[model samples]
Target: MKPAIHPAYRPVVFRDKAGDFAFLTRSTMTSDRTTEWEDGRTYPVIDVEISCASHPFYTGTARVLDAAGRVERFEQRYGRDGGRR
Candidate 1:
């Protein structure tokens, strides 16, 4: 718990450039950019390429692998296509 040893933890805005989304949060990151928030206060703004707002996983736009189809294809090739053992 040494003073002045830690980076500044302050409120900053993270803007997702692709998704056009922005949010305010506290972090130790610094930025040379500043923007006026909805609260009429100027804070350091960091532009990110992707965020939860735009990420495929978080946005539920990710393409799910067809494991079941592959398994069925394998079973058919192995002579186990729903036949009784």
Candidate 2:
């Protein structure tokens, strides 16, 4: 690998706003915002709307869509016999 050609990987904090969760990790991404971490050191902070902590799939709180009801309504409106002679 060549020097000065790759982005620097440094410690940063990712915060999930909805879940109020945060973690420290190394990433190439840059941010203007900073926050003091648990280690008493300042690091770049990135705010996210959703993360594994708040995701419906991971939390097992997904909502099921009513597909059967929609299909039944469509069939009723279009006619059951297809209007064929």
Candidate 3:
């Protein structure tokens, strides 16, 4: 709200090399490197290791652990045989 107290807001590009994905968003972050966008304007670029494109959940490659099944197996093996309730 104060003059010169807020960081400069600018359009920046986030690149996910692993997933070959890139997106543009406004941020206070800056980069020494820049690239010309589709509109022919150069903007600061930020490299990200993980994004929606590369994330397991977003990519539909998440792992499901069977913890409940494991617990049942443990109870059958130990809890019923001289084990406390």
Estimate TM-scores for all models. Answer: 0.77, 0.73, 0.79
Leading candidate by TM-score: 3
The per-model lDDT (C-alpha) reads: 0.94, 0.93, 0.90
Q: What is the alpha-carbon lDDT for the whole of candidate 3? A: 0.90
Identify the superior model by lDDT, candidate 1 or candidate 2: 1
Badly placed stretches (over 4 Å) of model 1 are 69-85
Model 3 ranges with Cα > 4 A deviation: 70-85
* After superposition, candidate 2 runs with Cα above 4 Å error: 65-85
Considering only N, C-alpha and C atoms within 3 Å, which residue pairs clash in candidate 1? Answer: none
Question: How many pairs of residues collide in model 2?
Answer: 0
Q: Residue by residue across 1-85, what tens digits does model 2's lDDT show?
A: 9999999999989999999799999999899999999889999999989999999999999999999999888779887766654
Residues 1-85, candidate 1: write the lDDT tens digits.
8998999899999999999899999999999989999999999999999999999999999999999999889888776746656
- lDDT by residue for model 3 over 1-85, one digit each (tens)? 8899899998999999789888999999989999888888888999989999999999999999999999889988888564965
